[model samples]
Target: MAHRYNLNVFCLPSELVDTLTPRALVGQPPPREPSPPPPTVAPLASAKGCNICLGATFADVDEQRVHFRTDWHRYNVKIRLSGGNAITESAFAQLVGGLEDSLSGSASSDDEISDESDAVNTLLSKINYTSLSDVPEDGTLKAPLTALTWFHSPPSTQIGVYRMLFPLDTPPSAYLSELKAMQATVEGGRKWAMFLVAGGHFAGAIVRVGRISDEQDEVVQTRKRKPPKSKPETEVLEHKTFHRYTTRKKQGGSQSINDNAKGAAISAGAMLRRYGEQALRDDIRNLLRDWAEDIHECERIFIRASVSNRRIFLDYEGCVISKGDGRLRTFPFPTRRPTQAELARCLQELVRAKVSHLTEEALRAQDEAYLASLPKPKPLPAQPALESVEKPKPPRLTKEEEIVREKWNRLLDMVSKGRLEPLKAFWEREGQDLGGIDALIPEWTGDRRASILQVAAQAGHDAVVQWLLFDLHADPTTPVPLAWTKDGGMESDASDAEAPPAGSRRTAYDLARSRAVRDVFRRCAADHPDWWDWFGIAHVPSALSKEKEEERDDKKKQRRKGLREKMREREAREREQERSSEVVFPVEEPPKAKKEPPSGPQKLGGSSGSTDGIAGLTPEMRAKVERERRARAAEARLR
Candidate 1:
């Protein structure tokens, strides 16, 4: 007979690895260092299951026969190698180690195999208890599996697969550690889930790891409408997973199914409430269906805005991320292109401010109007019309005028005669009685008022004219006296004996302006310049020189000439009185008369015709007469 080897010796279940019987080999054992042959199969029935041992056994079988079928053994075997759940060969090691240690301490008993089987079952119970302690409180092992869902195959496949749902909402890190541990013990590596359909019954797996990208898409590229508050928070939930296998091959496999999806966003640990899970799934599906459409809109925004060229301008309500240098900047948004909702809010605010401002304005206007309506004033009584009153005509100077001039002349003559008191008294009595003479007097009188003033141009009397305009209410825009004069009296000598006719020389208008009337000139320029001739009065040089010289010389002559006549009268009266004194002779002595008669015979001049008259003197008489003659001659010489 040929030696026999039982290839079924390799089969073991997760619950009873420690209670299996060791079968002896029929042939000699192979050397430790012998070359290994290619793996061969035995018939399926050659290995038989033992419920008490919980292990497979095989008798020798013909060549090309495989003993592979073991239902109880396979179920335990499958779970012991799965990656995500706690059922695995590594989990069984935990069960086996403790079981072997408990068996080693027991004494041999009649039911030793039965005790061993009971001990294995008890060890399996302990592992199950510990594993249950580690399951999440969410009641689903996939709850913490992150954005990736894993899938496993039935008996046909050795490893499982993984896939990333779009818009994923689980973290990637949650499964990575657990998967790595599972991959270490499983021959073909751990598989991840892809889909869970109709609850957990029909789970599909793709043995590849899938992952969403870490980077985010631009928010402006995603939506024109305002995103909900949950948008950014939701992005953290999107993720990806990889269907990976622990394999040693010429080339390593890709790390994840979504390795090419570099910019996809994902969330972590974000879950709906238990009751809202279905709703969340529906939302996710809808979002997935609309994702491409949303993405295309974002691309359109990018194209239309030309954000890269600075042509696509995004008007944030306030600040947003800066296009330059990836920093942030702020600017006031322009009025145009405001979002409808934002524009509505702004207009509401503006209307409120404007209404407030208008209310203030109305209050101010009302206050002003009320103040203005309080009180006012009234007019006073009217005065008599002075401007319409006719000026009194200057009293006509009768012969008294001539007499007055004469008296003035005579009084001045008396002053030259040194009769100063009488001259002053005459002025007080007569000149002062002429009440308006003060007004007529010029400022520079040269001690003779009329003569010097007569030659001066009327224009020079500005002070007098101002007094007339302001005090006397005279008008200035009237013709001068000369304008009416025909006989040149207005330019005449001061010695003229007769006055010009009332209307011939000086008119009231002329007199009014001759004085420098201020208000009169102002009023004339304002209201009556057209009424008066614009041409200035012509100044006659002859009149100028003659009036000046004649006035001066005539004044002096009048003073001296009157004094000369008075002096002539006084000398004439003295001569007449002297002749009368000579005519009334006084009587001489009688003896002198007799002596004169005798001497006269002796002849006075020795002429017979005048003998008596000439002989009247004697020698003594002749001597006396000679003495008188000598004295008289001396007196005459002295005179």
Candidate 2:
């Protein structure tokens, strides 16, 4: 739907969807509607009546001015600022103070108006509400960044909403007839509900029939309110899957096709959308259960869900509503993602009394403006007339004819700098139209009319090279004007370089920029050695076939493994030495020398001759014995 805020908002509901729809008006006389004032009544004649008060009109400017000054207008202004529709004057009159106090009350700010607000608050409290879920902390209008809520409906798929109008011209019978057309009746006061579910967003509530009438014409619009402040920051949830990212590992390839990668996005997106669908279903079921009693009170249920998601809300296990329920109906127009605001808009567009201000002239002008705004259709391309008298061949578009200008650059760029799957898929699906896979797939684009295979090989796209040579049986020896000099692997991007000199041709083998790409060409040659004239194409046949290449790769891998092991061993040794040097301990001193006792040892001989452990005395033994004897004597004396 239109992403902008609606401006011609003649009526704004306090809630996205009401708790009740209007009671059907079967056999009831239409409510009296306001008619145009006589031309002589200048004050009222020019006025279309007060928009704030849904069913109110002013007799004159003085009355309108008086109404503007009342507390009711101030109360509605607060409500509108809070993102709610204004209540009717009659509804306001039901307040405890009634219309008397309401009209008598003066405009006040903030806290000063508490008493007046209390009355309106009490009236609101009477309307029981069951919120399906908490309002997102960030406004729901902003799409959530999480994969859980990533299923944004494609652009231009939904109908846009611009304005809402309330008319006094519709009759009671007309409302009843409309209800009848919807297979709903005037049986319950809980008229109809709007249930919407998409992308984990669910909004469902009963909306009652509401009509405009003449009453207090004093319903003045709320003005001068400051708009809500914008948040300084918004949260961005990171993707839970890596499949959606572009590795940019490929050389030249179709990015659009590569980015999608067929089954990858379809499955990933479907998974996310499926989760949201189930979540939405549960939310709808929860709200329906919350309003089970309310649904019994409802006359009809308006649902906006796609075919796949419809059953989730309408016919899931133990669901209150069924797909075939007579009360069930779908929106006539396209709808946006299921949110409370969208649900409210649907009701406003569906059943609210609307007045079209556009006359035939205005409509005509609108049509002309619309036509003027549209992009003009392009003229058909001219085809050459056949001069041959031979029977005209069935008119078939030439396979050699270039693709549409819109897609030409995309294809060129994609092949040059995209993933492999897209290039393979593009050829698989549109190969015939794109002139099928050729060994020398020439792209006569811009100043660089080089072969696509040459671009792929030069860009280090081994996967694309493999697919082309193996699956398409493309000859690696097929040559084209080279973008590089004879340096081969040292060449710069071909797309940026000037065109080669006349007849400077090279095969994809010559342009191979990486070992992986060369390996692919080698494997292709090994598989189909006789497929192309290698000599004419300037391709030097490899001495090693695919098996020999693999053997060489194996030996290189083993050498790399040995080098990595040695490096790791050296690092470990360095770390160990560092740890040992970081620690220190105290050193011990050598023992002091003990002096020999008297060399002539008579006492020592007497003690030594008596066979204690000391037998023959070396000079050292006699000194030790003497010292022990002296120590014992000292110990005996001390004791």
TM-score of each: 0.13, 0.32
Where does model 1 exceed 4 Å of error? 1-463, 466-506, 509-550, 553-559, 562-566, 577-582, 589-639
* Candidate 2: C-alpha lDDT: 0.50
lDDT of 1 by residue, 24-128 (tens): 111222223322232333425644332211233456542112322222233343333321122233434444443423444223344643453544445444334
Candidate 2 weakest ten by summed lDDT = 233-242
User: Over the stretch 47-90, how does candidate 2's per-residue lDDT look in tens digits?
Assistant: 53555555456777877776675657755655554444566655
Evaluate all candidate structures by whole-model CA lDDT and list the values in order: 0.32, 0.50
What's the TM for model 2?
Answer: 0.32
Error of 1 at 42 (Å): 99
> How many steric clashes between backbone atoms does each model show?
53, 21
